[model samples]
Target: MAQSVHFSTPVDTVVSRMRALDTALPERDGLAVFNRVYLTVTEEFDRQLDAGLFPDRRAAISLDVRFAERYLTVAEDGRAPACWRPLLQFRRHPGVRPLQFALSGINAHIGHDLALALVDTCRTLGCEPADLEDEFDRVGDLLVSLEERVREELMPGPDLFQIADPLTHLLGSWSLERAREATWAAARALWALRGLPDLAEEFADRLDSAVGLAGRMLLTPLPI
Candidate 1:
């Protein structure tokens, strides 16, 4: 047999898949750029989970895997909802910076996939969205740190940048903290609407379109 691999957990499985992508894609490839960032996040989640950082480990694992699977699905098939199209479609454009790709992917994943993942986790665990609040907050804290790094490393330095810069406005406009809060609210709303499949689908569709719009804006090619 050419392959015989076993994952210790679902997190491990995703981590491995991400590692594979990281290795397979070109260094400058847009998905590769985002893949590296996401891999770091997933690894941190796994480490924190192992260290008992999350109170409900099972719920955390479920949510983390569910959320990641959404992105992986798009990555695997090259077919995704509107929310993911901007990043995947513009991935190879030279004008789109690595930071843009990274943030765009995060925007789609957190703004759209994450909310649905929360509802998925709630149903899988036979619980409600409130039960996963701790995990949600914990992950949000991680994304906040990621956002901070994106700015520090990607934004222009004080010597070169002005207050009226478009890039400055773009970076400032996107906030993971606000996105997390909105996703939490969305998850609650989605869980409530689960009983009404038609309405829920419509709501989800609108959300997908809105997130795609945000993602497309984030990916606006710059002269940088």
Candidate 2:
């Protein structure tokens, strides 16, 4: 029997899980690096919710919780998608920069899991993606803002050593804006393919694999 989708997951539960990871994981650990960045974003969302920033509080919370659950499940279960495999495999390597780990994780979560989460939210709410567009855009804006903060916080200090570094170039190659645009398109495409389960699965799998390949490249251990 197909499991029923429920939209009642409390925001506190997911926030607590993130807080626990923040306390347990080392600051420089790849998962920790990503977790810190993500945790900040989640916290901000929660504050926004309290402020009544969302027009549909239930939908916002549902989307937010569902989006987070995907990452938490992968982290705890070790059943990560291909896009997340590189970060998991290379997380502890001394050669990988903190920014690389952070961005790679973001790449995987936003690139693949985000689209699926959108679909998950839709099913739970008995609504279409169009119905949740406002929440999606608001969340996307928050992500973009957090990405800026993450870059600023993780970027190496200015110096010739930092300016000429490969990490700088590698980080420069990817853009959160482009990723967000792609994710929106993917989410809409997946929703369109809702009736064609096999095709949708194939599309999602291809997306997962492709994002994973990019993550692997991003995590290439640098001599610096």
Give the best candidate by TM-score: 2
lDDT of 2 by residue, 1-224 (tens): 97644343488788889999999888778998999888889988887887779999999998988899889987777888898899999999998888889899999999888899999999999999999999989998998888888788777786747543777888888987898889989999999999999999999999999899989988989875
Q: Give me the candidate number with maximum lDDT.
A: 2
For 1-224, candidate 1 gives per-residue lDDT tens digits of 66544337799999999999898888988778888888988999988887777888888899999999999998877879999998888989987777788889899999999999999999999999998899888888888897788667766667656532767677667888888988999999999999999999999999999999999999888775
Off by over 4 Å in 2: 1-9, 160-164
Over the full model, what C-alpha lDDT does candidate 1 score relative to the true structure? 0.87
- Once model 2 is optimally superposed onto the true structure by TM-score, how far is the C-alpha of residue 25 displaced, in angstroms? 1.6
Residue pairs whose backbone atoms clash in candidate 2 = 83-212
Error of 2 at 145 (Å): 0.9
Task: Rate residue 169 of model 1 by lDDT.
Answer: 73
lDDT of each: 0.87, 0.88
